[model samples]
Target: MRCQPRYKGLVYIWLKNKQSCLLCNEPADGTAPICMACETELPWLGDHCETCALPLPAAGLTCGQCLKQPPRFETVIAPWTYGFPVDSLITRFKHSAKWPFGRLLAELLAQFLQHRFDEALERPDALVPVPLALKRLRQRGFNQAAMLARWLGASLDIPCEEQLLKRIHDTSAQQDLKAEARRKNLRNAFALAPDAPIKGRHLALVDDVLTTGATAQALARLLMEAGAARVDVYCLARTPKPGDAT
Candidate 1:
């Protein structure tokens, strides 16, 4: 039997084609679905850690965590800090299966990444989406990371290797755990897919958000150990330091 789409009706298609600003419901300014005003008002990330994209008070500085224990990934490119309308939109897209919100975010992120590439950020050979555990996939009816990767790949003209990584364990959600616990929870939680062609290839992992960097570290370490030349992270938003507000 053919599988039904996660979103049920023509409304999904309409929303996808809708030219209104998702945040303000006004006509979009240009090709993107969000107008210039709303786009400017979005929580665009400011001076941040050069390596991890963690929001920082000053520019061109590395966070202490990265200074002490470096991560496996080389760089993280996020356009915004997880706050306000971006957080709300992500919640709706991920939990409520609101694909339009996700689509718009992915489109904007694609544009942001392209600009970085033009400015000398090395483009990855392919985009690798952080995998979802089968249980969670079944529960959610879709994997948001995979969706984001595909959208970005199409917009950027890069290949998206959705099957390159596998989530082997159904560990508890990372949000509920502290940073250290988050790391421990991912122990042996991921593995490279069989015959994955990662050796010496530069790859960027795609996801909706980066919180503690635990998940990205684990996945990137696995790929590095398996011979990938480099791994970077590309996500829509990155969360700020745990107690501080963005």
Candidate 2:
């Protein structure tokens, strides 16, 4: 987690001035291909729950659900709430193979995480992407979480362990399920790779979004049971409670 900043700093400096904004085609103003105006207009997450990163009115407060039944992961870190152009961008990136949009989001997420690392948030020893099932992977051609993880790992200099987890079976798509059904859908859905070096090592799960967190919880619990010291989630965005508009 403790990295020499000069190398990444230089890389970002090069990234900042190299290309036009992907969103507006204007000059990029920061560390990614996004203009200053468009960047500000993105749905940046405000203060939220300490555990799940759920959007909330106040800071330093855990949401009620986490209080009642604690999650296996230590925390969730997401830069934006799922809405607006963020949602549209992720949709296109995931479904339409718009790699640039995904790359742009991943770069910005790396910047957001770098600030957190500077502020002394403990960095994970490795990034473990949430794996897609074989059927879905065959159809999609690529795993969005794996792509995000690789980009983040390259930018942040963290090791990406793409094979640490595997989806054991395919299930109904989570987006179509309610919170309770989401949990049920993920039951027995994942497994740790044999001989994975998880013991006592902090690991972060990388994904595109944190919805009900059912997927994260199942995977994190598996890792923790496998002797992982801690687990955290890193994602592009977090959705508000179901049926709530942000």
Candidate 3:
């Protein structure tokens, strides 16, 4: 049997029940939590490195760093450069337990991923969020990356595996460390679950932000050692190289 179309009035009422813009408090145009205007004003990563998604002077090219030594992950997909309101939103979401901001960011990232999937990007078999050390998880009461991953997984109908990667060390935070130090700190930091069957699987590592990328690299390396065929990094924002402005 063919289903009848909803009345125009009913559609409008349903739309009204959706969320409004968290930044400007304007009614969102569609499923997004932010209005179109605010979305346009976001620090969109226009031109970036094809491999790392680092902001570049031009698009469709690899950055020198990637050419010198490629990262473990194949490609990075981030919609925004870590700047302005994006950084502020992430800080609040991660530090202050502001779940609404996190949800808004995750919704936007999911939309971007959907577009990529539509445009011939290969979908991953599962999403594994970069795990937090037990100490940090207890301190924060939640893992921000896990929350974002679960939200995106539900939106995109992909499996979210929180226990696929385990953090075995309580390393110092990466924020204040130099790039080399960050890499060193994350070395041997992540371990794959012994019983997880990941052979030949294409996996996407979900995280809130990509800074120096040390965490993602560590996790990706672990997945590769476990016989995973490919690893892709997915995050909301990517920060410019250390000491470089966005």
> What are the C-alpha RMSDs, in order, of all predicted structures?
2.8, 7.3, 7.4
The pairs that clash in candidate 2 are none
Please report how far candidate 1 places residue 2 from its true position, in Å: 16
The regions of model 3 sitting more than 4 angstroms off are 1-16
Give the whole-model CA lDDT for all candidates, comma-separated.
0.93, 0.93, 0.89
Q: What lDDT tens digits, residue by residue, belong to model 2 across residues 1-246?
A: 868544431122334447677777887866577888999999999989999999988989999999999999999999999999999999999999878889989989999999999999999999999999999999999999999999999999999999999999999999999999999999999988889999999999999999999999999999999999999999999999877777
Q: How does each model score on TM-score?
A: 0.94, 0.93, 0.92
Worst 10 residues of 1 by lDDT: 9-18
Residue 155 lDDT in model 3? 90
Q: Rank candidates, TM-score, best first.
A: 1, 2, 3
For model 1, the stretches where C-alpha displacement exceeds 4 angstroms are: 1-18
Best by TM-score: 1
